[model samples]
Target chain A: DQQVKQNSPSLSVQEGRISILNCDYTNSMFDYFLWYKKYPAEGPTFLISISSIKDKNEDGRFTVFLNKSAKHLSLHIVPSQPGDSAVYFCAAIEGGATNKLIFGTGTLLAVQP
Target chain B: DTAVSQTPKYLVTQMGNDKSIKCEQNLGHDTMYWYKQDSKKFLKIMFSYNNKELIINETVPNRFSPKSPDKAHLNLHINSLELGDSAVYFCASSQEPGYTDTQYFGPGTRLTVL
Candidate 1:
């Protein structure tokens, strides 16, 4: 049972264009969502996060939008750069003290310069 | 300095062999966790320790064990390794046990069971 799912295996976009990655979750208990970017042979690095109380959060070029009714969330990168090419994983944490994260299979994003 | 470090970045062994992976965090976080990523790139939590106390243990096999001597170190030991155990293992840390805390992950150790 995949609690978090990213249906797209890969995505490609031209440099300086908009890039969007989608994720869906089945668990309603999850209250916090985060996005991590990972390079080859490296661990995932935190990119952005959003709390259930908020519908959208933005930091610089990255933005995350959440729709509770749809049970979905998305990460948008504007003016994508070549360095933005990496595997993106969406993770969610159940509400309460135990913040254990459930991660998706990840989406590979490629930015062509 | 590395915030989270795991020794033996790569491990190759035969089936039924016993091996251990060591992890350490210099971030002074109170919580540590072990996660496994399979060939399909699915990351799943195996165990979590807070201040050297076991807090979460997922539905893993008995052959796998996690030990934490202190808050900054958490180790995973696998016995009677199986082919299915071949995957990338990541060690992570958080400031506290709550869900709001952000986790820092290590480079990961690739374990291949022959």
Candidate 2:
């Protein structure tokens, strides 16, 4: 059972444009959500995170919006650059547990120059 | 310097073989975790250790065992390797156990069982 799901397997966007990646979860117990960016042959690096208490969080060019009622979250990157091309994974964790992360299958994002 | 480091970046062995992957973290964090990414790119937690004590043990196979010699090191040993064990293993560390804080991940060690 995949608690977290990234419906889109791949996405493409033009440079200097906005890129949006979507993720959905079935588990209601998850209170913290995080987005990770991974390059080929490397580990997933933490990008941005949002707590259940807040509906949105932003870091530089990246912004994450969460809708608890719908159990959906979306990541937006403004003015997407070529360096933003990578696999993006959305992960969720149940609060007050061991902090075990449940990750999605990932969405490959390609920013065209 | 690498905050989280795992040895044997690539390991290939035949079935029924015994192998081990070592991990170390220098961030002085109280918690550490081991995650496995399968061929389908699904990442799952296999085990977690806090202050050298086992905290969370997932429903992993009995062939896999995790050893924490100290708070900064966690090693995974497989008694009998199988084809299903082929995946990229990652070691991560955090200041505490929970999603409130960010956890750092290593480069990952790719294990191949022939």
Candidate 3:
């Protein structure tokens, strides 16, 4: 049972354009969500996160919008750059002291220069 | 100055063999975890230890054992490996066991069973 799902296996966008990555979750108990960027042969790096209470969070060129009612969230990168090409994994923090993360299969984003 | 490091980045062994993977974190985090990414690219948590104590153990097989000798080091030993055991294993750490804590992951260890 995949609680978190990134239906899109891959995405392509042109440089300086908008890049949007979407993710959905089945479990409503998840209170926190995060996005991670991973390159080949490298581990995932934390990109940004948002709490269930907040609808949106922005950091520089990256923004995350959460729609609790829809049980969906998306990461938007304005003016995407070629270096932004990587596998993006959406994760949710299961409600518990352990803070166990449920990760999606990941979406590979390719930015064409 | 790597925050998280795992030894034996690649491991190849035959079925029914026993092997171990070592992980260390110098970030002074109090929690460590082991995750497996299968061929489907699904990342699943196998075990988590906090301050050298077992805290979370998912529905993993008994053949997989995790040992945390200290807060900074966590090791995994697999016995009677099977073809299904071939996957990439990642080691991660967090400052504390909280939902808000960000985890730092290692480069990952690819285990191949023949």
Candidate 4:
């Protein structure tokens, strides 16, 4: 069964606008979450991550917000650029003895210039 | 230099054939992992190795085997490949065997079983 889920398959936004992608998890044991961006024919690149204790984390134009009560998290890219277009995957880990990352189905984001 | 590299960008073979995929990392990481992205686009972990020792083994078939020659190299060999074996395989590495260490992924190898 899929513990992490991203219901949205695709999203489109104009350049310079804020783009938001959402993800949810059913397992409460996951203590860490991460987001990865992947381009066509290329491997996923690490974007940002957040711990279960922290509610929010920000790095430059990318920000991740977590809501433990809702069992959900989101990735926000402010002032989105055309280069930001790619498939975004949300991954979660239990973080103690297990390092295996459970990845979601992924969301395809398109930024129109 | 490429931090992680995988040989054979694409492989197409008939059913029941045997093949191997090689992966190498120059980042001096101590952990390596193999992940498969199937048709549904779900990336699932197949195996993980830390310092050339098997750590995490998923519910994969016996036809699939992972071998690590050293800390920097991990190879996946599949025998009696089936039609469902078609997928994109990715090799990744980390400095340690923990989630705190960010994993770096390779370009991925597309395997198609006919």
Candidate 5:
């Protein structure tokens, strides 16, 4: 079963605009949400994260908003740049000692010039 | 210096063969993990070792085994490789085992089984 889901397979946004990537999870046990950006032939790099206690977390141009009631989270990039174009994976940390990560299928975001 | 590194960026092997992928981290982190990314780009955790001790072992196949000789090294050994086993394997390291710690990932090793 896919505990985390990214409905959109791809997204396109122009540079200097905003880019939003959405993710949803069915597991209520997940208390931490994270976003990772990946390039082709490379591993994923951490972007932003949010805890269940907080509704939003921001780091520079990247911001992550979490809604526990909706079981959803989103990553927003302000004034998206070409460098922001990459595959974004939304992951949630399962509540337990293991603290394992469950990832979504990922969304390919393209920032147009 | 590279934070995390994996040897043999690409590997092609025939079915029924055994192969090992080596991983090392220089960040002095206590936790290391192996993640498998399939064709669908779904990254799943395979195994994790913290301070040279096995911590998380997911529902991976029996043919796949993970060994951590120390806190900075984690290796994945696959026996009797199958076509379905082909995927990009990534090694990651974190200061701790939980989600609060940011994990750093290696470039990844792409394994192809024929």
Candidate 6:
């Protein structure tokens, strides 16, 4: 079973615009959420993260919003740039001793120039 | 210097063969993990080691084993490799045990089994 899911396989946005990537999870035990950006032929790098207690967290141009009630979270990038184009994976952290990271299928975001 | 590194970026082997992938981290982290990205592009956790001790062992087969000589090194050994075992393996490290909020990853090792 897929505990976390990214419904959109791909997304397209123009430079200087906003890019939004969405993720959903069915497991209520997840306490923290994170987003990772991956380039081709490379390992994923950490982007932004949010705690279950907070509704939003921002780092520079990246912002993550979490809604526990909806069991969803989103990553928003302001003034998207072509360099921001990459595969984004949304992950949920199952706290406690398990401390597992449940990842979504990932969304390929293409930023147009 | 690279924070996390893996040796033999690519490996090709025949079925029933045994192979080992080596991973090391210079960040002085106490936790290390192995993740496998399958053909369907699903990244799943196989095992986690903290301070040279096995912390989490997922539903992986006994043929697969993870060994950590120290907190900075974790190795994965696969026996009787199967075609389904072909996948890109990644090694990651974090400062806090059981806390993966911010983990660094190494360039993956792609394994192909014939």
Residue-pair clashes per candidate, as listed? 1, 0, 0, 0, 0, 0
Q: Chain A only: give the TM-score of model 5.
A: 0.98
Cα lDDT tens digits, model 5, B53-73, are: 989899899999999988989
CAPRI-style class, candidate 2: medium
- On lDDT, who's better, 4 or 6? 4
- Model 6 misplaced stretches (Cα beyond 4 Å): none
Q: List model 3 lDDT by residue over B1-114, tens digit each.
A: 999999999999999999999999999999999999999999999999999989889999999999999999999999999999999999999999887999999999999999
**Chain A TM per candidate, in order of listing:** 0.99, 0.99, 0.98, 0.98, 0.98, 0.97
lDDT of candidate 5 at residue B93, scale 0 to 100: 95
The better candidate by lDDT, 1 or 2, is 1
Which of the two, 2 or 5, has more lDDT? 2
Predicted candidate 1 versus true structure: per-residue lDDT over B2-101, tens digit per residue: 9999989999999999999999999999999999999999999999999999998999998999999999999999999999999999999999999989
Can you tell me which runs of candidate 3 are displaced by over 4 Å? none
Q: What tens-digit string does per-residue lDDT give for candidate 1 at A8-84?
A: 99999999999999999999999999999999988999999999999999999999999999999999999899999
- Report the TM-score of candidate 2, chain A only: 0.99
**Residue lDDT tens for model 6, B1-113:** 99999988999999999999999999998889999999988999999888888888999999999999888899999999999999999999888765544888899999999
Ranking of all candidate structures by their DockQ, best first = 3, 1, 4, 2, 5, 6
What tens-digit string does per-residue lDDT give for candidate 2 at B1-114? Answer: 889999989999999999999999999998999999999999999999988999989999989999999989999999899999999999998888866778889889999999
DockQ of every candidate structure = 0.88, 0.79, 0.89, 0.81, 0.77, 0.65
Candidate 1 iRMSD in angstroms? 0.7
Proportion of native contacts kept per candidate:
0.84, 0.77, 0.89, 0.73, 0.77, 0.54
Question: For model 4, which pairs clash?
Answer: none
Q: How far off is residue B94 in model 6, in Å?
A: 0.4
Extract clashing residue pairs from model 5.
none
- lDDT per residue, candidate 6, A33-113, as tens digits? 999999988888999888899999999999999999999999999989999999999998977764567789999999999
